[model samples]
Target chain A: MQNTSLSQANPTSEDTSKPRKARGPKWWIDFLVDLAGIYLFVVRFFKDLFRPPYEFKEVLNQCYIIGYKTLPLIAFTAYIGGIVFTRQSRPSLESFGAVSWLPSLVGVGIIRSLGPLIAGLIGAGKIASNIGAELGSMKVTEQIDAMEVSGTNPFTFLVITRVLACSLMLPILVIFTDILALLGGFTNVYFGEGVSFSLYFSQAFSTIEMEDIFASTLKSVLFGFSIGIIGCYKGFTSKKGTVGVGKAANSSVVMSMFMVFVIDLFTLQIMTFIRNILYS
Target chain B: MADTKSNFIKPLFDYEGRSRVVEIEGLNKSFGDNHVLKNISMELYEGENLVVLGRSGTGKSVLIKCIVGLLTPDSGKLEVFGQQIPGMKSYQMDAIRKKIGFSFQLSALYDSMTVRQNIEFPLKRNVHGLTQAEINQRVEEALDNVGLLYAIDLMPVELSGGMKKRVGIARTLILNPEIMLYDEPTSGLDPITAGEINELILQVQEQYHTSAIIITHDITCARMTGNRINFMYEGEFVLKGTFEELSHIDDYRIKPFFEYNEF
Candidate 1:
């Protein structure tokens, strides 16, 4: 009877009925969890970016996709935006006898804020959306997993190359947007206010500083990186199904544009503080 | 052939006698209280075409995932090429994965890349010191083997379903892997195309003589490609045998599956 009871107790002792405890929290728990996922993804991307058998071909492909392919849209919209923005601001300035200040006013506005912001917004629509949708579709179709199975790091191949391309390319695109906006501002001054080309040219540079142009251009780089990385991240980690792809693309542009403004506001504040200490 | 216990028992324990390449013992995986794989065990030898036949949700893909270290089993021991791999680092797994190839069901060809670029991707990813000429040669050879040499410059979108599958196979072949894992190589294709894919699989099997594990539901595909079949049902293998042995088995679920002639 004792032997039988012991045998029954041994089998029962090995029972799988005890509820599995939840994974507990610990020191560096959140850090470790977040590390291997998105944070590790970002680190791996940078590491692979500098490493060789560098996908120069894929980089060129991305340049075409993110920069060259979207040029027409960026150019056309920037031109129109410049024309409209100058014309719209003319009425408001004219009400206060600030009409003679048109060129400097427009120049300051373009270099300081409008130039980077508009280009980033348009890029948010064009580049970010494209990155998200493309990667989202890849994720949904198992193409990303296939890359892993084939011994190719998908993040290195797909995301890093794209992020690098956007980082390198968008600043150049912003430069183009600035040039077109200048042309458009000149055109608006000529057509809307009958100002001479020479007068508009001289007035535009009268008050503009090297710092203003430099700061805005630098900000666009951050804007571009944010857009590129965020877009790629959302798409790369997308779940669910076909609808998930669409959501990723949509969310990428929205979230990136939001972050761009947030960064811009903080940058402006920091720059103001630095300038106050240095020049004032 | 007689319905003997020895044939069934022989292959299950053949790991000791034969040169085993992949040995998975006592695999148990669960996703938040829902058990996906329960005590799954199998051994694959060199140059053997092993097919895992199962219903849709029997963790067939999960099993292959464990082999490749894509999904960690909750409890198990999996050895690949004599390296114990349960909680191995990704870099270590990457070293091991260099000798493995996986062809997905959707083909998973990078749509952003052209056919030539897709095939060249693996060579570019794996080999660093090779010259442009050597890379080009390998890419051409792989594309030629898959019969897609002409479509090199065309985008993945331009290719047909069969052509995409061939490109996918070409990409896998670029790595010259020692083991190949095929996930439903032929599911949605028309019969003729499916047969062509099977022929391609057979051609690869003959030429490379690498160990292959095919996870599929189609009996016709299994019979055409697999040298040995393992019937996976309810998180475990219900029966495992050659096509002839499984056909002769006197069981309910196993009977119609093996004997039914869809071909």
Candidate 2:
């Protein structure tokens, strides 16, 4: 390792710039490559999913790690977010003489959109970055290659478990988030809006039909799955070096954030369409 | 002496030369303008320890990766267990991969997993339809073999460098792979620890009777564990011989490597 540094008397300016900027191609080409990589990952994952010695135990272990372990962080974030959002939104609503509608409005809005969206973003920060770094380090150490030589499918074992865990557990987390956010709104009504606890819940729940809750919950599930899958994918496919690992971790967060936005827009559109068809 | 008798008495090295575990012929790989492996051809027989010695960037690790189907060569005929590798389907490569084990130089135990969990990972995931008890037994046996039975529950971070390498060995052995590939097993270890690791490699090689191809520039380690050592330079296998024979070679290109103790 020391010899590697001795041979290069000095790094040229171009060498430093290469890491920060992707030269030799237009920006559009780089974007297309990134898009293509995402597409290929999705296609390959589905392709290799069912064929072979199944890694059920690994998937279960991942669920325990990714899903079960992340519970406290998700719950704490959601609880605080709910309380703070409601508390902050209360004065504005009161000035408009809309204090009575606090529970229904905050409850529906938080559960339907903000709760899952913010939760997914937090998951990106917490779970996605972790997955990237962990798998990135594994790549750098050649553990993934070791797995391959040992006649084990590194992808099937490592990638599948993590992706599946995130896909399955993220929905459960979002459900918890939804409940916590509503409780926070309920608390705000009791303390700030001068409404009784039972009255706030009953009124809040009355306005929120099953469709509203379900639509938002569904989006969160997809959001969670996307975050987990993209994070693990980037990390697992990282190049075999220290720099590669850092790049993988950085890309995982960037791609996950982009996916969250894209998925949110599409989900919102579908939700609105459903509402229009049902009510109209 | 009893030492000679004990060494001779150990029938672990005996192999009838039944099958080839790894075969590389006319292999060629290049990274951009720099060629890494050129016309490389070698065969790894069952129960043989083949050590590859090379300087940095000599395609040693790349050669191992190609055998495992991790990286595809530019042009090559590579075969493992009678299956052609260059054109084999991904699923096919996966099937062949199940019969191999790898111990990385960096002791690539998953940081998030406990030592036991790391060892159990390959078996728990790859070997289908095994009962939970069976998996546990395998994990225990693997850890015991590497003398890491006590540290099973500890995370990778808590273990020393030596302990981490042992856990990596146990993980590789969980599947009882027929072939094991080691990449610079002693590169980053202290002399004493490195010796211990070499002993562990010998033990695993003996007990499992698995064919091993180790990539390292450490001459001491190669001498201790290698039955046949191949000297690689500039993407070529410049010399191949038993360690005893290679150490005595008078060739100008190879003699300096030994004379300077540069491996």
Candidate 3:
């Protein structure tokens, strides 16, 4: 054993060499690779969801964190948004002698588009960054690796639970945002025009169709998925060190928001196309 | 390279009358033109501590990671308990992983969990059908083994460096693994703390009768824990012997490590 061959072993003589820079591929190539990685992540998540020992406890914990913890901030922002929009629209409607339309207009806008979009963006910023940073730190510290070597599936415990929580919770949070925003709108309309609460709500409900509610709820679901998946992907693939954690958190927020807009655009187009087919 | 197929037929413990738990042959790992491990080969037998001593970046940690199937080698034959690691699927690797415990350099305790929770994590996951009482009993036993029973309820953030390492070892020992892979187990501790860790490692090995691969630069740790020492330089094993045998070696690459007087 002492005569173990060293013919192929070339000893490193000096330690003066600079650490190699991690040269990334071109932007387009990087984008394609990231897209592929996210696609695979989604595929793996679906594959693992049906497997045994579902992480129900972790899922509930995440829902508490992602949904319950986010209510105050989401509600506060949505309420302010509703008041600001109503105030901005009041003068224009009053000039056009369409003040009576205030309840219907704001109600339709809040229920159909503004509510889900704003709530989705808020969830993306709050929940996405939270998940990213938490998991990035775990990766950096080898907690994730420890979990794996201990025969626990980190993907099932960490990624699937978080993604499901965000996807399920975001829609519920958006409903809450829509209701709060309408209340805020009602308050503004009452002060501005002395509209009775009964009359204002009647007008509000009269203009919001089943299709509008359905479309917005569906959009929120997609937004939630994008936010959860993007956040998990960024974190799971984080490189070594604290800088990697920061990057993961930053990019999770940015990418989730970007995907929100992209999903919004596609959902609107698809809704319009379906409506056209039905009417035609 | 010399008829390793015959090794498969040989009884699991028949490598010179000692059972081989981990076998590596012609292992090569490279990171984008920078060769980290070059045709490395070694064997870890049962009931013995195998220490690999090397500089910080000489692939010691990488070798252990590969053994645990965390890092896929470029090309090599890595068999942990007769299972080919590089080609094994996730579930297969997971099955093998259950029998092996890896204690990371930083202890890698979960910051969100208390010491008790961290130790119970593996037990709850791997050993099914255990009641909570049984789990708690095992957690206590593991912590007691590492002399950290008093720190059970404390979170990882509250523990000092040596305390964290003890907790980490306790967490790994909870599974009662057959093979242990330790990555720089005493790299950042003070001298006294480092000596304590080394003694704890020795006690654990003797008590559990498990084979281990400890990668470290600490001479005291190497001397205290290793039954055989492999001196790695530039991703290759430059020498292999006992501490006393290697101290007298004339090779300059292997001389600096033994020259240090500090314990």
Candidate 4:
């Protein structure tokens, strides 16, 4: 009796995303449910990961989109990061009359942390939000259900492919960021101190080892995975209507960025643990 | 009130002889504390368009979604082809889903793909063992059936609202589903466009011999497409009969629905 018009094709019959006023006892329940939901989502991802007539074409397409389409931004940001870091550090090094150490310092910084973090943060914002919004739109429009009814396992085709693309492409993007950043550092140092390109690179790389590169690559892969999974989860579970799509996109960006930093902290500890065992 | 409750609507035509392809008894669904569906029971007879008419928020869409296993019911005896749908795993449901074609209200076409790609989707995934040429031929035929063969190359965004619905039908028909679930087929459409869609629904029921459960509030569509009608309110059927039987009901619950179509 409240209204007479139809719901205009919204799934779930009613708008389930409408806020409930009282949350006194519901807070803990909500938190636990969300956590459990994420856990099951991850489980589904892994379960579908191994058993599949793999969506190779979609995976490749996602790689090209995630990697190739994102190259310009990654490259530009890393180059700027290298320039700014070098510009700021030059004066400090010069005051101590130890400017000779600048190249080595720049190399370590870029390879060990800066490149991976930049790639992850940018991927979280760009890639994860896109995944969230795209899938969220699909969810609201019932494209995911359509896929299911059409006999395509949506988790396998959509979720697995995007996540795999992210993992595969992140390492590659991190490498590009690392190389661009160094080239940017070289440009700055070469102009400021008149250092030759070859000599600058040689000094820069002198202090870096295989461990630094391996750690950075690991972080990149983990960042990619986190970005993909969080985005997919938000999108796949989005309810209500177009409003839910917007929320999904916004939360995906925030959560994936948070996850990127979390992975960074853990990876740093992991790297230290390995170093102690290896170097000892 | 007691007299009216005792006089609940019944079928004027004998559909008991028809085999029920979809059967529901005391079906219930809830989202948190909001119980959307409550003790609902219905049956979709083979090759008949069973329209469940209800205003927004009456759990009409939820019912169809439950039928197709897209949404699980909280408690119910919901079945398609007499197989219980609620507890069936997704893969197991896929076998059943191949026989059900669900044409979404918004068409739900893959926007990134062309119309031809959308039509080919169910065929490429569900109806395996077909060659590329066979797929192409079938896609063309499906499009031809919907009178949109020229739009095969166009993206979903480029097509008009009616065209999108037609393409959606083409896609589902490519699978030749035994049961078609049309969720608000004419909800957001103009009367003329809605009439075309209603005609298409009837044509599908005739040509493909599909048993359809059309969830709509459009009385015109309900009249045109439905073999029998059930008017739902607050998660339960308030009235149900053939259009002939329902149009004459003087009850307040049923008056507004048939009032518009009255001569």
Candidate 4 C-alpha error for residue A60, in Å: 0.8
Q: Tell me the docking grade of candidate 1.
A: acceptable
Give all TM-scores, in the order shown. 0.88, 0.84, 0.93, 0.92
Q: Tell me, by DockQ, which candidate is best.
A: 4
Q: How big a share of the true inter-chain contacts is recovered in candidate 2? A: 0.27
Q: What overall lDDT goes with each candidate model?
A: 0.80, 0.77, 0.87, 0.87
**Model 1 error, position A114 (Å):** 0.6
lDDT of 1 by residue, A62-180 (tens): 98888888778878777887788888888998899898888888888877888788888888888999899889999999898888876777877788888888887878888888778
- Candidate 2 per-residue lDDT over residues B75-145, each given as its tens digit: 97899998888888966876777787877778877776788778777776678799989888888888889
lDDT for residue B260 in candidate 1, whole number 0-100: 64
- lDDT by residue (A57-93, candidate 4, tens digit) is 9999999999999999999999999998888889999
The model with the greater lDDT, 1 or 3, is 3
Model 4 scores a TM of 0.92
DockQ of each: 0.25, 0.20, 0.35, 0.36
lDDT, candidate 4, at A187: 91
Writing each residue's lDDT as its tens digit, candidate 1 over B1-263 gives 11234444233313334577899887888877667776667778877788998778878988988898878889988999999878788788888998898888888998877888888877877878899999999999988998889999999889888888888888888989889898888878887988888888888988977789999888878888887787777666667777666766676666676556544
Measured by TM-score, the strongest candidate is 3
Clashing pairs in 3: B13-B19
